[model samples]
Target: MATVHNNSLNRLSAGGLLISLGIIFGDIGTSPLYVFKAIFNQGTVTPDLVIGAISCVFWTLTLQTTIKYVLITLNADNKGEGGILSLYSLVRRRAKWLIIPAIVGASTLLADGMITPAITISSAVEGLAIHNPAFPTVPVVVLIISLLFVIQRFGTSIVGRVFGPLMLVWFSTIGILGFAYIDKAPEVIKALNPYYAIHTIVHYPNALFIIGAIFLCTTGAEALYSDMGHCGKSNIRVSWIFVKLCLILNYFGQGAWLITHQGNVLGENNPFYAIMPDWFLFYGIIIATVAAIIASQAMISGSYTLISEAVRLNIWPKVTIRYPSDQKGQLYVPSINLILFIGCMLIIFVFRKSSNMEAAYGLAINLTFLSTTILVIYFMLRKRIHKLWIVLFALIYFTVEITFLVGNGVKIGHGGWLTLLLALTIFIVMYAWYTARKIKNRHVKFDDIKKYYPIISELSEDETVPTFASQLVYLTSANNKEEIETKVIYSILNKKPKRADVYWIVHVDVMDTPHARDYTVNQLIPGKLIRIDFKLGFREEQKISLLLRKVIEDMVSKGEIDITSQYKTLKKYHIPGDFNFVVLEKVFTKTSELNWPERIVMELYKILKNFSLSEEKGFGLDSSFVTLERVPLNIPNTGNLQLRRVK
Candidate 1:
């Protein structure tokens, strides 16, 4: 059961609520930094456009973020765990095609992971350049993002406590500033009317295109649901009330400021900072920078959880994971960390400003939103929820998201392609890894254990065969105790004729539950052959060596087996016997008989296998006492060639 675990689903409390604010709201909370500016960037800032844009922001947040995600999607938690993957796990058995949406949604969320930090930090740091155009904010952005990544190894347990208070101050400041300005232009409140949202689309020249920026205001909504398990639904739902209020107040404040400057172009000047009184500018930038960093932290943490689950589900290549703290779901993957750092640096180096990075941002996450929508609808259907609401949910989200997708599509050449490209790359890897596993299992031959029991038992007592180890163990993928891989049989009898006092077969079954840990043991032979099936949750790490050792200790205490060394002197001294593990490594040999698709899958599987963690480390086996055996996965003589008998 050892791995990074998140207990965010523990209970409803003040601490949880605060953590929810600090963590769950970072993405959406920081959006005021750039969302309004992106809308104005598309064209001239007219009163109608400003009013329509603010209206779109309000309604979009209401419909997209609040209703769709916080209210509906958050209900589909996997054992109180929420995320696209978690939701998929709840109903994946309902249909095979569901895997597609799961993979695509998860990939896009990860893509969002890359772009969010770049844009959030870039937006915050851009405030410095706002005051002094000569200020070098690029290096500052790089430095802040770099420091965040560097600290992941230490864990966020210590700093996470302050995220809530920090965000509290940020929201309070934004709300106060916005409320203060609301008096300047009370007419801006008219934008909250849904009519203004519809009017913007009809009257604004680039209204449809502005949906891209509108999508940004709620980009973090999915993340909110994703982290629901970390912060109980009650905590999230409660904190959201405050978070949304402040966010709306700030958006309205910024709107109030924007409408005043109508017909006057605010080029390269952010309304968020512009709306702030001059005295508070420095302090405001400081608070925004801190909030942005925290936002980036939450996103990065979410990425780790996403990839960790992907690995456990066998959809992604295995990588080394380190638990930097006892906190649930706190894991550090060096590979992903480095990849994100490089990606962020690339975004900073290429996009150069928050506005440019914004162009690359919301495009991929819209795909994520749509993907989650499909899963959520199916999940509701499975729960026997009324069909009427399901259809309504689907229609409303599809209409809004498709419009946003098309709007973001216009940014394809303007850096949007970057995130889409990264997401597609991740999707391919996941698809390839998933399909290759199925293909590999398709050709594997599982033999009846009864047929081999006699051979195995006979060979165990045969003194002529060399003693392999006192206790010989093999990890098996077979779910049935009556079956074993034929390769294991051949390795035991034909390869080196390994003989041992007792043979142990271990099978691990990954359950869908987040933290389940139940196991069953079968004693096929009282003193010679034994089988163990461990049922672990996908979130649980497989520490086979340690677990097996504990199993042996329990057995020894019960006098089930004598594991003392076979040597006379050692047995006299009561020295414990040695245990050795045999790990099977597959080597695929491409034959001409393989079809193109099969070959492609096998080739990719091999390439991925090369980069993936080795079976020894992935399974948490003790390398010092393990032996690696390579087996050829060659098709058994597909005699398709018509040849003369040359011999």
Candidate 2:
């Protein structure tokens, strides 16, 4: 499936290019609305300052977006999928500590999701102030954002159809608007020179802060790489040429306008709008708002995909995932949507203006870029590329990303702390969930299943014992084919002696590749005892009930096993036996000993578990035939008791 998809992606068409414009470039494509506004806000505008900032924007897009991501990082895809997690999956086995970078990158990317909508929408709406100066944009911005998030449950198929065309109009409009002013001050073209970029960094006032503002130009570059799987590498690469050209035209146009009014502080007038004629101002504002909403929608959808992958990878707790439409990969996560909505609302109420939100933006995403650089280095190493090329790659990207990180770091005191705090909170949750699972698995005791086969077989044939069901199924975590968890055995024999006609154990293994699905069966005791191992890709859904039924149908068709009722009366009619599923739910007991850090981790994990989906729901099992079994994790140690029993 992945191969076919990638092959199709390689063949580009007009529709593919349009979809790329809509989905892949929405974030960065909307940057012109605020990138110049942000840079000019730093200090007074001058010819040198204007030229240097535009130069920095040009090179930043080239190095960060074009070279690093489009050329290099996109090649690290995992089964035709691209993202930080997809990249991590390709090289996770090489180093266990790589999880740290993955967690940090993923968490920060989410933070970017929340802040992007706030800034983009606010910036677009702020344009209304030009006409009346007293027009309240906050309420309008809030209303637009609220509406965008509210419609998520209904799916974006209808609105999504127009995204590509609308964005096409948007890019063309901005390109024309920017091109109009370039001839007025044709000297602005010199900003494309690298010497000006160096001059601005060396001699400009508050150069780090200026670089931070420049960082916003390519903030959506990460999204460009992430959406690679959606519209094929060919489409994105081809469409980016036009997108980049439009963006540079707009930036240089803004620079031209600034140079004409050099040494003047830009207060109430925004260069993005000033470049437009007064007659087109109203329509331009409308276009900008629509573009902002489209950008926000893209971010919201990407957030859902990100959280879904995290849950499947076990780095995030399982949450309720809803398929709002039949469109592939169109999912709505209620919990995430609510969280992001509230975050955006809070940012609007607090910051109250796009300029204020700008300080909070770019900081978290800078960390994400840094994390990607680190992960990509390891990816290059695993591919067995020459070490010299690896070192050079490391030196260039590491230096560039680290410089951006430091630049954005200055925003920490000014509204940037909000995003940093949000990222930190998300990181804690991911760490606690991942580490707690490790701690729990460390003490899990597995018993060899061969020893239990005799008793299981005997119980299946015992006439004295009442049959619990015709078939009994248990979900196991044991990776070894010959071993099963002791808790599973306890549930079968010691807990209540669950007698049945046949016993089945099923194990699910999440593979490193995306979209893989295959299963194998091991018949330990022929028809009486069977084990099924399912290998599913990280992106695949875990619908065990449906999968189990299909596996049984295959086995029955091949004459490998009989699923017909063993009861004499039902057997005569050839009726299928009812199967009962038992799902083991682990709970921490008070008897378990742990250090302070471990205890803190467990406490956090418990809190997160309370909000997560139940084991049955997470695995997509039917609740009607499923039973929940609470098993104590880290079984009590009697030897460590301090008091002796009274005689």
Candidate 3:
């Protein structure tokens, strides 16, 4: 049976649609604030420029956001869980090289997280400059960003409640605002023609740069697919219809306003604010600011989710994750939050303006979109979609994305290199963590548990050895029921010779499905040895200490095992026996020989291990009852022994 993963708002309902609007659409929804302004800044505002830009925005949303993500990619969910990693998990068996795109997509998306807040919040706050030209927006932006990160520890459930309603208002206001201006330049509707989009690029000056600016409108498209798990596919798909309409209206409305001011340079005057009525400008600014905050929140929360998933997938090092609320899937990672906060602060100080930050924004996300495109094509291939359909889908998106990439390539010299640099740094960490594990696994040796059963049985009854615990448990990596790690046997019979009344070998398998929590128990020896295998989803918390207790309780209820202490004095009282856990930690040894890449990976892995959570902590085991054993990880040197003994 498939495991059922439930979110309160995961079902299709009015509430779900509202939540989808709030959570999934924040990044793309708020693009109207700066997209037109960025486009207008590129060249003179004319009939061709305004209409062409709006047309490009419309098709990008339709092709990239609406068709690609909402209609198609949302269907590729892994047991209703969606993200680059989750998608990778679904089709990963199809190809090994798929890991490259998954890592690249995730890293770039995370890089986008840092710039999204910096750019969106700065754009909203910069509206203050309209009223007071000398107002310093940096400190205000910094304060908002800082407080946003600060409150992340307390959870966002309370604040999250207002997101849907607030975003609804944001979308409605922008749509209405856009509709009001469309009458000023009815011909702006001509932007719907593909000809205008083609002509603008072919005839317009700096056309490639315009396409780069236009790419910003669909930046939040990936979030729709990533967050499909939070809100079901139905909710996201339905909410997107309404969202796309409002976004189109707002973009067209801005075009209308800009067309009316043709031939005049829009000198630092934002067309977004310019279209608003004098009476509603302040209110509009306030609404935009709140929407910007909502967008930032979505990105921040998404970053946390991404890092947590990455950790579980073994691509990222283990870090401390705390659940501050009773809500499912709501977690806070302080290390990630601190890193994002620092990245945002650095962008604000360095760029100092949303315009400059915009130059850095779309480039990283373009790479992310291209990576998603690559994954989706493979996803289609896996589904065995018709060859013609798959080829057409691949050709269209690859061409569009590569074009966007080249257009955004212009940003490399301006400010785009910053986000690319951030993404590259993140990729290195994931690559090193993942590659080191593969290398480590190559050296690990397993022993047949059947061969040691008699020896362990003898050790349990041996009066010469002192008792280690009433019940001793070891977490094992061996997947087969009849096998255990050679080191595990070494630890028991060779290292210190631990004796116990009962021995338990526990193994946890992280599955691709998001919420699996089933386990199977086997009695390797009656009343002497037990093996329990837990099949948990990647997103499931690994609280082995608590989960083991629950498993023991269930076993006790079923009369599967004896819990009474084996000691003579305690046997009379019928008290429960003590349980101790042994966690083997591998330490890198200098004697191990590796190729250059392996050595580099192991060296970085060593540094990362020092900073990461301990094995016991990572497994969610209690420290007091857990024994940490350091095991050397040594690969045999291919060369002959250098030291020779004198006979």
Candidate 4:
């Protein structure tokens, strides 16, 4: 599997890699805005504290970001796909224990998706105040958010194209600024050493005021794993080498600028913008704003993809999925967009400034980062990828990450609770949905085709039902007996006697991997009605219509079902008559026999059924040729009695 997967490394192109870097690296790229400012503002630190803090940031990026993410997590990709859900899908069977971490990581990622844009964009907008203190922050923040929502409808391709160049400029600008400051305080360069990091922590005891402050440098490191499909592992690996170098240089420059000026302009607030010359402030604001928007774009795009993956895996409720491009992984989900919009607006309204939002920001990113670390450990152990190396690396990185998380955890009383609360809520809903779906599916008797076959066979003969009815297809579960029963009931109730013709219960099983084209079909119950079930491989995204067409063609070629029978008119040599679809909707009761949580989940699932793709579409039935007969079953109690039907 590793050898087969490694083949994708050859497919990475220069242009694609650059775009991936631009999109995937945006979060970490913009970290300089608040990371340094947060650390130096209120945190207790002696003169040597700068060196130690910078040392921790450097090493954290090396061990946590570069080593854990770029090296280890990226290797856990499921067929070139990476993300919390993707990782979960791959290892869920082998390392079921890791599912907890996967869920936490994914939930936190969603939380980051909501708060990142709010914080990043606000930080950039706050840069505007540098140009003109009179610039109203709240209105500008609202306007930028409104425009972001407006453009999301069109999709991000156009915006993505601009990201690369803008980020390039931002990096270059920071690089130049760092170099200018490096000329004056070259001694600050010593901070990159590990000794400095330890010295600052030990010598300057107060330096621990906000331990979570270091979280800024490593915030988006998870992107290395989350976006493996969009940007190949090698691309992120290579791009980060340069990105990290540039960032370190900039941080060092900021350190130098502060040391030389002795924090003269710091004024207990944003020294990031304050350090720059007045002439460059306007350009810096523009650059920062663009960087913020790009960071927000990455968050939005990543969230859409994550939710889409979740839906495919049945961890999330079915939502409308739109592919704006033929590009493999691109997707747009509307519900997520609206939710993010509301959350972001509220954050801006409440926080009002980027500095305040900082307290709330790192919580989600750190949580997500820690979750990924735990999963990566399991991933490595499962693959036998050097146990000692994996354990040692995970222990060191986890300790550092948890230390930062503690700081962010402290802010929970402030605004950090919002992210954690939202994450937990989403996690519960998603986990409940997945658990309920599994339990309901488990109880379903998929093999009961015997009970359904008779009904389907009878339906074929009924002249009163629909004159155009010829081809009858029942969508059933995998179990043969249950499918037969479902077929029989429909045939008996709808059709009169029974027509001599081909009938079958077709079951479509969706796979985890995308673009899965292969399937298996069974011809059970012989001539009158066949129970055909398709077991799709993980890589295939199942479409019932495509699979059915294939099944029909295969059967016709084998002389099992006549190819010449007219679908609309029954003829012995033609393909059998018009198609009729029968779908069995899962009925739920408030007082179901299942546990309370399961019952509640089923109720929600029932509501969601209405919004799911119609049976006609799901079963590959043509709009003009399909008729639906919905069967409602009673919710069983201790006694079997038909109560008044409730709508």
Q: What is the C-alpha lDDT of each candidate?
A: 0.85, 0.89, 0.89, 0.70
Give the count of colliding residue pairs in each prediction: 5, 0, 0, 44
- Between candidates 3 and 4, name the one with more favorable TM-score: 3
| Model 3 lDDT at residue 565 | 85
When superposed on Cα atoms, how far off is each prediction in RMSD?
Answer: 2.1, 1.9, 2.4, 4.7
Ten-residue stretch with the least lDDT total in model 2: 1-10
lDDT assessment of candidate 2: 0.89
User: TM-scores across all candidates?
Assistant: 0.96, 0.98, 0.97, 0.87
* Root-mean-square deviation of Cα positions for candidate 1 versus the true structure, in angstroms: 2.1
Model 3 spans > 4 angstroms off = 1-8, 635-639, 642-647
Off by over 4 Å in 4: 1-13, 43-46, 95-97, 202-209, 263-269, 446-468, 479-500, 525-542, 550-560, 563-576, 590-592, 599-634, 637-647
Better candidate by lDDT, 3 or 4: 3
After superposing candidate 2 on the true structure, give the runs of residues whose Cα lies further than 4 Å from its correct spot. 1-10, 642-647
Worst 10 residues of 1 by lDDT: 1-10
Q: Which candidate leads the pack in TM-score? A: 2
Error of 2 at 47 (Å): 0.5
Against the hidden true structure, what lDDT does model 1 obtain? 0.85
